[model samples]
Target: MSETGRLILLGAPLGNPADASARFREVLAAADVVAAEDTRRLTRLARDLDVSVPGRIVSYFEGNEERRTPELVDVLAAGYTVALVTDGGMPSVSDPGYRLVRAALDAGLPVTAAPGPSAVTTALALSGLPCDRFCFEGFLPRTPGGRRSRLSALAAEERTLVFFEAPHRITGALADLAAAFGADRPAALCRELTKTYEEVVRRPLGELAEWAAAGAPRGEITLVVAGASATPAQRPDDDALRAAVAEREAAGLSRRDAITEVAAGYGLRRREVYGLVHEG
Candidate 1:
């Protein structure tokens, strides 16, 4: 209600028009300007809702977001309500509208949201995985090396992880996830949520990878993976610790280095491992 203007972020439906809220339609239809990731898709959505968007619709996507943010801010500064929406889900969540929102706030313009459905929460809830705490990793890098590096970094993350992936890359993504997290890691693949022919496959990473490789899935895909298990607090027995050090030593590490590495791995002091390894 500020005199400067308001930037309303509307959460579009994942794939169902019915998911759009009454306030979403009200704000979208009455806004002075609408910044949409895909104007065509927004048009279709408006049509589906039997609503008329009389505002000037402009394209605001990843490719053009940086360039268009200033212009949108100018409109907001002029005291015209601007509704920000993406192809799906909330704006600025791995989607467009982040720049404009930031710009609006910086310019002291009002900003708010009409929250709707989100694939992150939907998939997490339907995944049957622990959702008490979770993290949403919108999408992994498209490149193999980049994806592997990112996955490797997240291998030990303890919170349930959610990710968005393209239909075409699901195979390689699942494979990399399995290799990084562990083949037996439990994961759920939610595809085409809220749409006809929707699918939710819950399985181990290894099996999901194999299934993707066998046949390409064709829809928006959300992956929910169980977090890494916490390392047990119980310390290994002396014999086990000694054997661990010996295994590392056999792998070309010097006794001192092997003991150090083993100790760190087992959360024990170096001297303790050293003593255990050299014990009479």
Candidate 2:
């Protein structure tokens, strides 16, 4: 493959055009073809940067990504420097460019990137959480049960975690996170990142949950949650566990259901809860 026929992933400005890198402009103007998640947004961004792209511009987004990747791959293989950009942030990082990039790589085509602003890093930096070791969770499942199960699975994740949530679900998501990761966990809610009205609210997860419940904030949101601290060596006393189980059971939960609920509440394994219940 010719060196010129490479796939380049470009990270666009998250909210500020000034954050666009010099390399980003040079590559965008040099590509043989530009595939963007939103063609209109790409055009607008190009106008904003005053960069004229003399290449074919096409739409590639979540809905059409699977169907369009093969075509884009063909363009890359045909000696076209295919430049991929998302509406904002880094392409393929919770965006629509992963499939095309993967296909290009597998086909032995050269691939590269022009790094620019990213909401993930921006929010993490503003979060005041431990960013040294962190994980980007992208987005949570929309359904209540699926979201709950997903959060439950991440209960033991030790790295600080980041997530993008819509404004409307902010409160409920925070509540679910509190239930999964313990209310005392520290977190930050970053809104309208890099924009004129940007706001960052840092607090314990429990307090965030309460604040969200009062009113949903406007603008795009990014949440950074601190990981679990060292769990206490000693488990709750047998009487305490029994009382929790009994309380749930009295609230119409079956013995089995109450055991599960109490176990999750205390971050204990279900088997351990069962053993304790039986022992008492």
Candidate 3:
């Protein structure tokens, strides 16, 4: 049990009330002050969970987060348990709650969390992409120019990338992604996660862009994109390719096998290697 005068960050289910954990219910019921991104939604959630919140319910969303942080920290400093809950997922994750958390930390107040469902991790797991290493980019800029600049800067990032996007902007975002990362870059679009109408679309960036342009789905969206290749982008010169093939052939390998080996080593197509060797 956390001591008094501590801040607890609560994680709400993405869309399903059934995803709420037992610990979350306990903490929600115990908090002295419940700062919610959406008070109405929080009320509905508490009703669904059959948990009684014997605490003050206050609005703590984006528009008022700045103004509310100091007040929440003051409450925490006064030996009260304050629980911060966003509309969904954990607070401060492309959502409200960061300011209040930072204020509490700076004031030497205790801060903890009741872990809940996360769209970021959920989408990454279902995307069928590498998850060993990844970077959460939150939401991209809404404007085309700004989004392009951000995407261009991240073009060479070797770790898998995750992002939150709006349904209305998904088409343009995917088009920009294709242009920056290349048409063939693999990606997944997860929609209405943990909800009845859940949908996951996996495709190349260009194809995704086309699909989105055709008709954008309505709901919260999470995107997972494959990383850029770690290998050097520059193709091997003809002489280099020829030399590698010849060296492999001298090591008791057949010409066909040598070409395949050399191509794999240089991250090139076997036909490129063959053409290089036969273009005498």
Candidate 4:
């Protein structure tokens, strides 16, 4: 391991600066170069920790990441320890710094982390949902149709799913999820994780939709949804499939759209529904 080059992937506190790990402070204090997603946020964090970064600090965010990575890579290759920090949470998890990490790894550079608070893990812990096997789904698309299409693709996912969403759109996102999955699906809404106003509400998707409708929530939001349950082996009978297609078609959906909707509802393949629609 010593023969390989090293790059530090530091996890910053999501909200509270005091949650920073001892290793996080040591690395920031001693690193030869610091690549931060947001230099202002990094500076504030440094002040919070009362640690001064002795090395160079450079910005590495989505807009200029491509241009900045090569320079950082050169520094790392020169045997200078480079530390990567995002505004909050772990770098490269729905945050900046993935490109640099990939570049470093492909070049056989060693990468390590100062583990600390993460919205993903923190939300999972606070969600009260099944965390044994889960997937992180970053943020969903903003548009209604695009978001719905994305949710449709994950309709059959068997493992619990976590998603980051804007507070303003939480209600609409919950409504869309309820439509894509079922209303009764179990889910949890974690808000302002690790902050003074942190909140976690566990309920069915339908109930969550209702709650969000009543009022908008503030702060960052993390949604944890229970996975689809195993269903009986028997396929939706032909009549059932036909009726589903008919119901959707009557609602003004095109034949193709109806098939997609019905198939998603029954957790069946679109082809299965198409076959039934034709047979009927």
lDDT of 2 by residue, 1-280 (tens): 3544899999898878888999999988998889998999889989999999998899999999999999988888888898899988899988898788789989998999998888999999877566899999998988878888999998888788999998888888999999998886667899988778988887667778998898888888999987765563456788989998998788766676577546545656667878988988
Query: What C-alpha lDDT do the candidate models reach, one value each?
Result: 0.86, 0.84, 0.88, 0.84
Name the candidate that leads on TM-score.
Answer: 3
lDDT of 2 at 149: 97
Q: Which candidate, 1 or 2, has the higher lDDT?
A: 1
Tell me the tens digit of each residue's lDDT in model 4 across 1-280: 1334478999899888999999999999998889998999899999989999998899999999999988887777877899999988999999897899999988778888888889998888766555899999999999999999999999889888999999888999999999998886767889988889988887668778999999988889999987786662456678977987798688766686567545544556557778888978
Error of 4 at 222 (Å): 0.9
Worst 10 residues of 2 by lDDT: 260-269
TM-score winner between 1 and 2, please give it: 1
Tens digits of lDDT, candidate 3, 174-223: 99999999876667899999999999887667778998988987899999
- Candidate 4, residue 200: Cα displacement in angstroms equals 0.8
TM value for model 2 = 0.80
**Which digits, one per residue and each the tens of the lDDT, describe model 1 over residues 1-280?**
3467889999999999999999999998799999989999999999999999999999998888888899989898888899998988888888887788888988888899999989899999987667999999999999999999999999999899999999889999999999998876778899999998889887668878998999988999999998876772468888988988888778766675566446545545556777877773
Give the Cα-based TM-score of candidate 1 against the true structure.
0.81
Q: What are the TM-scores, per candidate, against the unseen true structure?
A: 0.81, 0.80, 0.82, 0.79
Model 3 residue 198 CA deviation (Å) reads 0.5
